[model samples]
Target: MAEVTTSPRTWSPAAAPPHAPHSGGPRWRVVVGSYGFRLTLVVLLALAAAVGILTYGNPAAPGSSGFWVIVRSRFASVGTILVVAFCQGVATVVFHTVTNNRILTPSILGFDALYRVIQTALVFLFGAGTLAATDGLGKIALQSLLMVGFASLLYGWLFTGTKANLHLLLLVGVVLGMGFGSLSTFMQRLLTPSEFDILSARLFGNISASDASYLPWGALVCVVVGTVLWRRRHVLDVVALGRETATSLGVRHQREVLLTLVLVAVLISVSTSMVGPMTFFGFVVAMLTYQVVGDSRHTRTLPMVAAVACATLLGAYFVLRHVFYAAGLVSVIIELAGGLVFLVHLLRKGLR
Candidate 1:
């Protein structure tokens, strides 16, 4: 037995064992260790796919000048792929963030329909020959600017009005898409078969159809805009908490939404102008990004989303172009697969 004079030991809070388990133990480790490994793997896969596109299926000797020429030509396509993926991934993810809905994509805004209208109008009013005439940097610039301006005007007006709400904004966008699509259909009906044929090819979201000249401008714009978006990631995370919560948390919800929408317009416009119109491509990439990264944090997801997009598009390009000998069918396959996935997701959760 202990001596009577011995002081009894007390287990105070300060005296608690340091090695005891914690519910929040090393969370950063989980975040960093798991996400870092996955991100690194994805990035490596994307690099491999890009390299395969550059090196595979060349007829010339590996070190020959002719081999480099083929690689350079393929480089143009790969560059286009990067720009498109970067734009779509970033835009769709940001769009999801501001809207507080992962199910929605930027395509709902009638960007594709507007692009089709612009294309159909070119062939309808100016004739098929004018399509070729409009292939310069100027045409692409004008298209992007017009689309951005339209979106800015629409967003600025709707969000500032007394009745401002996402539902009304969405309703207007849907109505506009329908109207534009109708206008395009009516015009397409008037074109001769040959003119329609020429118009048809331009309307599909064909990465190969991108002009090499557009790559630099696209890349420049992507860098500038991407930086701006990245800087706002924290605000976006707040924004994702819904309008009421964001506003309660001192985040100007409407202002942020308007600004985010404008930026998204710039990205979608650039991508649409470059590769015609990609209705479901962004949706697919964004979906894959969410699945692979398994987190909603914008800081982690933004860059990761772009990397995932690059891998997906590059892999599709490599497979179809090399194995199937059907490079032109990339858009078709993506749309089909994306549509099915979209349906399954929609049905599984129903619309939020």
Candidate 2:
């Protein structure tokens, strides 16, 4: 009787197998079934439309050298738009994730205002000629470093304590941003008309103003920081669980928050340096991403946010440039639309 052992159990084809780790399906199919696949597809379609409108019907024959030249020229603007979209999209999403705030963007940390202050100060102190003499890439590097350093120091001081309060941090940031803005305004008022005009161009976020030379550096920073964030997606999920929960789960909550905020600062610096200040674009993109993806996980939401941002930027550029022939107005229109969306969101939600 003791030797009468049970036979090993076997799974039948009709019965589900024992639980095993998911290896994920085919790449294309997985992407197709993703939460924001339709939004991504729409963005791709809009990008194609934008490229077509920009490159088609050149005075040069379709296959001629001149045609290719025109296409290359058009691509510069498109490239800038895409870069700006990626930077803003990823930065804002990560920012909201780390801060656990839906209404706040990386820009709210005062990077944009700092950028404006930098520009205004440059013009006010050294004159427009000196400002114009500064190289584009050099300016980007300097501004990015300044912003990153400021954010690192701020986060280090404010969050690396046992009694850290995010609300206090945000409130302080808002006050600093307002102070910077007021100083910038005061400086601008004292400038000559010519100097103010030049500074004004630099203050407004404009895709056309992006220097092609800065693209390589901007793309490099974005790719490196983005890859780091992707690698830490699981960690981000844990962090989003709130500081106390994350700590109980063995996450270094303060350290992770500091690191995340530093990266956010870097991304915002690159975007602002490349294309000037975009106050509400990131807010709109992140909000739309949350709505479209319906997921809190960074892995699911980040790409969708990027796609929505790209679509918004490219579609707006195409309509403004080709349809209305007001390419210069693209940033203004975006800010206006984003502001309206922000207002609506606030009105609907009523501060939770």
Candidate 3:
């Protein structure tokens, strides 16, 4: 006993060294590594693309008054891009969530068909002059109202019963889309060549075609809708876990789906009415977003989707406009690329 106590050991708690927690432990986590890096990289690239588009090949010096004037003129295109990208990106992601299907896009919900019908009918009944004459807030509001109303009615009716089914809703949407397309085609066939030419321009999705006056209103809707979605990200996360899980988590799954569809309809409507129907743009954005985000959680997924969309659009716009001098084909090129990607995805992964 005396020999054992010879060292006179100090057993004070303060004398012990502290242990460091594992870096991978939840208690010690900081950054999200690639998730954060990719997101930040995308955002920076988007900013750079925007700067280039606004400043590149300016006729006047950067500090000159003429340069500022040119930039101001170009700001409309940039604003249009922002509004369209935001609307499409947000709408596509949320649409995927509600349907629990990544392959489907808001375009398939008949917005494009409805938009085409509206434009074609305008030209068919009142002639091509009405297309230009109808370009105002009133027309846009009317278009958005019709689209959203259609969605609300469809969702409300479909999700009302105990056997409320998403696939059935999708089937019905497809059938209706085909019908609308047929109607549009018939109307176009009856129109004169000159009328068809004007109608064709409206049919193609053109970012530059978006009226400057419509940008603010579109952006306002996006801001309000985006605010709602972002604030409810957690709830969306639960909803993404599927209906049973969401209901168990105290969320009203049916109500949420209806609400999400209605909001998505608004977004798609605004973008479609502003820039014509972007059939494959949102599909490609959502597909690429799903591949990049690496997480199903809406919190991380949503922002990443938005950044990727902005970067994609801005980079493509800058290149096609400045480099290729094919500014008018930006939408065409995007749709082509999107279609290729869609076909590839279908061949490889099917409809999951």
- Can you give the lDDT of residue 56 in candidate 2? 59
TM-score order of candidates, best first? 3, 1, 2
lDDT of 2 by residue, 174-203 (tens): 888999999999999999999999888888
TM for candidate 1 is 0.90
* Error at 30, model 1, angstroms: 6.4
lDDT of 3 by residue, 95-130 (tens): 889888877988888899999999999999898999
Q: Give candidate 3 regions above 4 Å deviation.
A: 1-32, 350-352
Which pairs clash in model 1? none
TM-score of each: 0.90, 0.88, 0.91
List model 1 lDDT by residue over 1-352, tens digit each.
9767868897888887675556356765686568788889889999999999999989999989999999998888999999999999899999988877878888898898999999999999899999998798899999999999999888988888667888788788989999999999999999999999999999987876667999999999999999998899999999999988999999998999999999999999999999877777778888888887788999899989999999999999899999998888888888898889888989989765
- Model 2 CA lDDT for position 193: 100
Q: Which is superior by lDDT, 1 or 2?
A: 1
Better of 2 and 3 by TM-score: 3
Q: Count the backbone clashes (under 3 Å) in each candidate.
A: 0, 0, 0
Q: How does candidate 1 score on lDDT?
A: 0.89
